[model samples]
Target: MADARAANERRVRRLEQMKTNGSAGAASGTLKAFWHGGRKPAHIVVRSALLKRVEGGNILTRLVLPRGVALRFYLLALFEAQCRLAVGGQWENVLPLSGPGSWSDMIASDGAYDGKSGTYMRGTRGGRAAEDLRLRQVQGALRTLEEVGGERPDQALVEVPRGPRGQRLYPSFRLLQESGRGSHQSPDIYTVPTDHWHPSRTVTIPAAFFLNGWVQVLSPSEVATWLALRVLSKWAPEKHQESGVFLYGDARKQQFGLRRDAWEDGCQRLLNFGLIRFARPMKDGDPAVPPTPNSWLMDFDQPEPRERYEPHRYQVIDEGLDQDAVRVCHRELTLRQHALDRRAAEVQSRKNGGPQQDVWPQWDGGEREMRFEEV
Candidate 1:
């Protein structure tokens, strides 16, 4: 523990020194480096086909996700873990897809919805009104499994080691391992590495965003669009935390095979959710030259203003119908982002030999020793 803390301190100091002296990785007055201790990255590994169906404007509504944040978190975690398990392994045959995650980290059920799966009420996590919300989330996940692996009912996704007594738990899926090489291939050729980088394409997102109940209410397409934007965010300004830093042009869209209508809907969903802010919708007149992708600014973690919000056309799942169901997503995101801001400030302050309010800001596992176990 001491060594780890010391290493973190050194890393902190090195980053501070770099930015202060305008050395490598220095940006305007801030550093664009990953903090020593910060947001817990939910490593996600997605296949190209899934995103195409979800984000690239698939017409089928069969695999549409349930608007529950908890289930979404489970899916993201499972997908990420499964990707890690795929590499260097038997990805060629009927692959058993699963990922290991603690209940607390994934669901945040706090033992409220432990044993009761079907008989559970709307008050599953929050209140009486939330009962249906939670149920639909479970349904969405089950349907997703059916969409992927329906031929064999026994092989369908299901939770293991059922929850204790009355406690409820989330549903899991078991899809027929995706298409790979021939069945005759030697077993030695396929083994998934536990590490993240082994997968050719993977992106790390803050766990809070997916787990936050606000994001859970979005349609699956909207979620994919948000994720697509995140992928596009890599091209944004690396040094600053501000949004509207990157552009998403026609070439990139063409390469990804993302249709304009799909792209518009995705961005519109994000805008309505207040996740991203567009200064202006795309301007008219232009088939020859691709317009600069500067109209939209990323607002995932940026602070939202208190003034009257712009006229938003998108509506929440239970908008105007339920009372407690409308947990202001923008407010939740703003708070999470605020916590992140404090973290960045602490890093800068500590480097300057000043005191830090909370030494560990986002999520802390610095004290936990590294261990490897079979999933």
Candidate 2:
């Protein structure tokens, strides 16, 4: 049976490869049309096989995709990680249905309660507070994951805060679970709003599509490079263009936290990434300029480039390069244009107001004919 399944899978893979080639050819045709006319073709061509299986989402549900994918990947990834870290079966699975459903039992067993379970629910003695607190944290993480993922998630595990009068609150996340697990025993991928499911349909997403969507994976090398970029970006070419020494000196002083060795390491990482290029290297036996205090070049003319070592600047990398960077750059350009326009208008106004201040009234209007007194 396994051999038969494997053969079928191989056959499917071969057919999919052919389909991809056809799609590429069609895409090339579309691009050619766009290049010629600057518009997409009125009719888009799709393989019959693809057309047969596309189940489009509803407008509201479709809108959810952006958040959905982000939350799903990040939260699920984090949850999986935490689960792996946690002692197996030591921490109970508390369904988020009730604020403290299973956790309440965990707390109630701790003898942290007084009257019946109902009494603790009504009164606050800080009883079972830990359970409630964990729930709160999970709730916060869930909300963050949802926004980041750009999708409404399975809310079956969620419950909102208590009402003003203390009634059970409605769930912010609505759960959508389907019956039965797949062959791998995974929970068959629950989603919010039930319309997204269909059997025998292949689904795929681009690798790195969530590049800046979730947690920024920071490596030591990457962190170092970011620090370097931050410091280098702030360099005032106008101020230090003449000496270049002041630039390195200031960087060394201001970036006290990152030592000389660390800075050099960071710079090495940045160089590897190709984000910057060296302007010039000091040659042996050449007279060197003394570095200026508190300048970007305080330690330049060194054997190697050094890291920028500025924390404030490294935040540029922490945020990650994404649509946000593009938007910010665009906004800055727009503002700069506005400022330029305003300055131009002011200059035009001055020009129109008669520039007689700089000229001596045109040599008193009539003293132009100097014919050497007819001599």
lDDT tens digits, residues 10-94, model 1? Answer: 3233333333322221111111011112222343334322332222233122234333332353344344344335444433223
lDDT of every predicted structure (CA atoms): 0.35, 0.29
lDDT for predicted candidate 1 compared with the true structure:
0.35
Write down the TM-score of every candidate.
0.37, 0.21
Number of the top candidate by lDDT?
A: 1
RMSD list, candidates in order: 19.9, 29.1
Tens digits of lDDT, candidate 2, 211-308? 22111222233343343343333343332233221123343434322335444534433332233334344334433433343332333365654343
The 10-residue segment of model 2 with minimum total lDDT is: 366-375
Count of backbone clashes, every candidate in sequence: 21, 30
Q: Which regions of candidate 1 fall more than 4 Å away from where they truly are?
A: 1-49, 52-62, 65-76, 79-140, 148-200, 235-262, 279-326, 330-375
